[model samples]
Target: MSVSTPMLVTFVVYILGMVLIGFIAWRSTKSFDDYILGGRSLGSVVTALSAGASDMSGWLLMGLPGAIFLSGISESWIAIGLIIGAWLNWRIVAGRLRVQTEHHDNALTLPDFFSSRFEDNSKLLRVISAVVILIFFTIYCASGVVAGARLFESTFGMDYQTALWAGAAATILYTLVGGFLAVSWTDTVQASLMIFALILTPIIVIVAVGGLDDSLAVIRAKSLENLDMLKGLNFVAVISLLGWGLGYFGQPHILARFMAADSHHTIRSARRIGMIWMILCLGGAVAVGFFGIAYFENHPDQAAGVSQNGERIFIELARILFNPWIAGILLSAILAAVMSTLSCQLLVCSSALTEDLYKGFLRKNASQKELVWVGRLMVLVIALIAIALAANPENRVLGLVSYAWAGFGAAFGPVVLFGVCWKRMTRNGALAGMVIGALTVLLWKDYGYAELYEIIPGFAFASIAIVVFSLLGRGPSEAAQQRFAAAEAQYQSK
Candidate 1:
């Protein structure tokens, strides 16, 4: 397919707009704190949308729709699981984490929060948690890079290698320049673009397919099994799909939003806004894939790209069904999804390196100016590594995302949950849970045992380890307990 001139113009304009936002944010970033956490000043709307956009990533538009297109309604279980998980996260973790991180010395990053929460004078918790974040988030960032490369390759008729760097350049530049503020501000815009594209595209697809009944009839004609939610799925398989929800607790990028909110009082509103946005976007994504079966079935000639890669369903639908200009804007949502998540993941990795490892270990007295520059440099380093990891054109976005998601969910989920809710959780117990949880995921995924999602066992094992270790060890320090009580009081009041 030749490159459409309208699309080229739209893409160029969109990229320039994001870069402009980065420069605007750069002026507002006066210190390392401002650079990393936007000075902890996000309101309900920005916090809500930024978190949603960062959480969804390109997987929502590309990977998820692709899964539904290939596997049918059974795949929607993942979305259902995610909704449940996200809602629970907003209700249970958001406000508490916001207040807890502040009470525990105003920690800016997850590792910082863990180290401070446990009063780990040795900094072992800081070091280990930072390592865990870097390891898993590198893989997570690579998934974003892969998703971006796919969009560029398909949309612009570019080859995979050239498309890879071209796709990542804008996101890297903005993140490097403006840091967290840039990422969060752009996320708000990107979230709006994403929701619009998602909602509108599916409506058009449904209409083009001649209605819901007709779409279902066409899908049934293609494969009656595709209509069954439990078609070829065993009980374990269904559970595995739903287990995706468990990942929210430990996602560094999404959790960062909660920690950045202006106050705990805003979280309730943010939660409501975020959940509504998430549900609508997810519903639209699922609809595109399900109805796409009918659309492509009725028009096989236009489906060569989708046949080659079901992940292209959303992209192909946008291009074929809308005017070139509108399709370009719609397709930009894919880029939006890719950039929103990638930028934040890059920033999180940067924070782990700059705050947790560099400043925590090497330069405890590093100046704000120096630290901000170091953080920017780390973003460049991680982005290059992720791009290299994403060099393979054959990598599936969903496959890569799931592996990394499970890693974080298993490793940090139980620890974070226990840390905020259980003041009795000792540093040793936290360490034990973190290490055992991470190791469980790595081993479980490697062995491919039980045909179950690795997170299920990893989360369970981690939770049990935390309890046993905490019970066996001495309790938290007096300071730690006092801090927990203070944060809990604030959370309750809110």
Candidate 2:
């Protein structure tokens, strides 16, 4: 199918509008601090929406709905797991990390925070953590690129290679120009678009199938098993699905939002707003896929695109059910999803390289102007690497996302949780947990151990390692203990 004039116009307008915002944000980005983290100036609303939008990525709209359309309601366990995980992260980690990061010499990045928190003069912690971030985030960014290419390919009938570069260009440009401020500001808009599409598309899908009752009837006629959430799921399978929640704790993009908030007090309001947005969006995504079964069953002739790739269910439904103009807006939400997350991931990777590696080792006294430019350069370098990885055109968005998600979750989750809550946690404990957690994920994923999600073992072993190593080692130094006490006191006051 060829792109309609309405869709082409809408796409052009949306892309241009985002670039405009980037230029606006560029005016405010004066230093490396603003470029990497908006100078820690985000309020509750931007904090809430940016975190939610970046966390959902293209997986929320495409990969997730496709899983349900392919496997039935059983796939929603991942959604359930995510909701639990997100809430816990906000409640347990958000304010504390915000306070702690500031208290620890006003650290600018996660590795910076960890090294300062541990007083690691050796900078070993910084190097190791930064490497893990670069490794997993490169793969994560590739997933975003693949998602954007898929959208352009499906909608415009463009060849995969052309779509790959074309799709990624807008996001890379805005992120390179505007940096964190641009990404956060655009994320607010993109999050609004994503929720609007997810909510509206499912409602229209339900009505198109004659109503909720009739839709369920059609689905029942097609396959009674589709209604059973546990139809084919075993104990291990269920645990694996639920384990997705663990990944939330360690995701750098999401954590960056927390670190950027204007005040810890804002986290309470942000949590409320963020959770409501998350639950509604997730419910709508599940509805689209589940109700999509009935719609496709009723209209088999229009099912070819979805039949070829179940991930295209939301895209096909939007085009077929809505007016051309409205459909264009709805489809743009997918672009919004892809760009919102990709831009953030690119920035985070750039930060890891510029702040953790280059500034830490090679140029400790680099000027802020030089650092900001270096960060922009790093964005382009990482984007090019991600584009190359996405060149294959065979990668599944969810598959790539899941691997990176688990890598971050296992490697960093235990360390972050322990570091924040337990001042007794020595630097060796963090190092042990980080290494053990990351290694477990890599080894388990490679060996196909127990058919379990790698995060479960990775998190469990990492947590255990932290406790054992910390206990066996000498206590934290007096200065490290004093810094932890001050941060803890501030958090308690909040």
Candidate 3:
């Protein structure tokens, strides 16, 4: 797959722009807060789009479309589940987390928030929470790398090993240079590019397939399941699909966006904008996969090539439907999706290492400048670890995402929910829930029922653990209760 001159130029230009943004962000980043959470200064628009972009990742362009391509509308249950989950996460968690993190001793990280919320002088909660973050985020970051490699491999015809490193090089450079602000700023731009590609590609594909009515006729004739939203959906399948929503509540990357917003009041505006963008983008992704059936039916030559790796449907559609110049831009959107999420994940991992481990334990008196440099070093280390994990050529973007999603959802989701909403949540109960939830995900994924998504079982067990242990053991201190009440009151009164 020789890269055309236009494609090479456009792609190079896009990568350079991201690098420039990193340099700009690096100049503005002054404190550890700015390096980790953008100093909680992001406005509504940047906050909303950055969250959306980081949340979607390459799965939006590659994994979701691939699922739809192979399984039809039945696969859309995942998107439907994510939409509902994201809405509830914003409505319930967004405003409170923003206010709570600030009120809880100016907590800058999730582990810090939990430690402060629980009043754990022992710092056990901080250690445990950070460990879980590192474990799951490494896998989560690897998934993004694999997705990027897939794009380069399919689009540029680069070999898998070379493509893997090439795809991650720009993201690591920007993240290492700029830190959190760079991730957020780049995310906003990437979100725009993602929506443009997702929206425009589907519209053109639908037209090429003849029309909405004609496309539907062809899809239905080809495979009724492709159009049938409810075909073969059982109780287990529905719960497993919808359980994806549970994962959002605990995803450190998405929650970081809420914590970084300028103010709690800004959440209302961000929520509306974010949800609207999510719905349109998700609809477009699904449309691309569904519409591809008709497009490929007419062009059997392309269809024959993509049959084995249906995940390439979006890439193939962009290649076949547009001129080289426009296709280059559209394909760059895929890279944008990959880099946006990958950079954010690396930054979060860096924060856990620097803040939770280094500053909190190794050198409590470390200066801000020292910690910032430490974070930059950790980002490179973690990105390299993820690159190694992603070197495998057989990894499916959606498969890796589902596993890591389940890990976080089951491990931290229950703890985060009860920690914020329940005044009685204790450090002991929190520990039990965190351990039980994380272990449940691993054990269930490996040995428990393969038919159900691990999140359902992991979440249920962890939530039950919190309730049972909190009742059986000691409750939160008066200080913890008052803080919880204060945080709850801020949102409830509004």
Candidate 4:
């Protein structure tokens, strides 16, 4: 596809608008909390949309569509798993984390929460959790940068490295100025645009292909017999795909929303709003890919080898179904998905540096002003590091993302679950679990066997290590254990 001047104009204007929002948000910052969690006062709609937008990211725009194009109906289960898992995370983690962040930890970041909860004043827990957060978050943020660059490379004929720098800079600059406030407000707006684009683009494609009857006939004539959504996929693949669902309970970026929300009262409303938005958007992505299949089917020469270029399905559909102006708007929606996620990831990475590392360790006496500056600086440094790592630009976007996702899921997922639910969870248990989970992710990759279940193995070992280590290390001294018993009682009452 030729470089459409209209599309270029749309992208530049959208990028500029985000930059303006970032600086606008920058005006409100007075302390680290304002920089990190928007002063811990996010409302229901902003919290819900930003969290969902950040959570879904490039995966929703490109990965989901690719999956539908590649595996047909079985891909839908992945969406189901995510929906259920997200709802549960909001139900279980959101409300409590908000209250506990103040009462138990005074925690602004995940590592702070861990250190405070266990009376980890020794700084061992803080240091370890900070290290864990940084290592995995680095890779996680790289995946987002990769996705952003890929979006430009795939859609607008931009060079990968140029796109990488542009994309990373775009997210980093806003997050630097706006911090969490910019991220949340921009994410809410971007998330809405994402859903609208997903819904509208596909509907247009379906219509352009001449309705359901014509579309199906075209698809049947062109696609593989197995492309049928129902009879097309095998049970194991379906299960594996849907198993992507189990990942939500542990993701840090998603969990951050819960920790930041102003009240538990917001959670119920957030859940309803979040789920409805997710369902519609995810459904739209699938429709775009499947309908793209039909649209191309009707025009055989035009449809050529879209599966291999699966990432372009959404872009191709925009060009085929709408005039340049509408297509430019839809294209901006894809960029929104890319930018929303990249900004959120960058902010989380910055928080780990400011709240978790700088104040917690390096400069123990750093002022709020210093911490915020450090956080902003870390954003550029980290984005540059990730861009350097992602220089290869040679992997499937979903696969690379899953590897990072699995690492975090294994490393933090079980420890968090056991920590929140099981009071016997000793500090030693948390350490053992983190080590085991992190190591297992590396080991699994070394063995090249993630085809089995990327996060499952690491999560299993982490859970076992936590139990074994906690039992082996002597239950907290009697007094400490008694104090924990109160925590347990508090847990039971809740």
Please list the Cα RMSD from the true structure of every candidate, rounded to 1 decimal place: 1.8, 1.6, 1.9, 3.0
Q: Write the per-residue lDDT of candidate 4 for residues 119-232, one digit (tens) a residue.
A: 665778777767766776677777878877877776677888888887778778899888999999889989988998998887787788889888777777665552555555
Q: Which ten residues in a row have the lowest lDDT in candidate 2?
A: 393-402
| lDDT of candidates 1 onward, in order | 0.92, 0.93, 0.89, 0.77
lDDT of model 3 at residue 95? 90
Total backbone clashes of model 2? Answer: 0
Which residues of candidate 2, in runs, are more than 4 Å off?
1-3, 395-401
Query: Tens digits of per-residue lDDT for model 1 on 95-126?
Result: 99999999988999999999889888899999
Q: Best candidate per TM-score, number?
A: 2
* lDDT ranking, best first: 2, 1, 3, 4
Q: What tens-digit string does per-residue lDDT give for candidate 2 at 246-305?
A: 999999999999999998999999999999999999999999999999999999999998
Per-residue lDDT, model 2, residue 331, is 93
Better of 1 and 3 by lDDT: 1
In model 3, which regions exceed 4 Å deviation? 1-3, 394-401
Task: Kindly report the root-mean-square deviation of model 3 from the true structure over all alpha carbons.
Answer: 1.9
Who is ahead in TM-score, 3 or 4?
3
| TM-score (all chains, Cα) for each model | 0.97, 0.98, 0.96, 0.91
Cα lDDT for residue 166, candidate 3: 86
* TM-score (C-alpha) between model 2 and the true structure: 0.98
- Maximum-lDDT candidate: 2
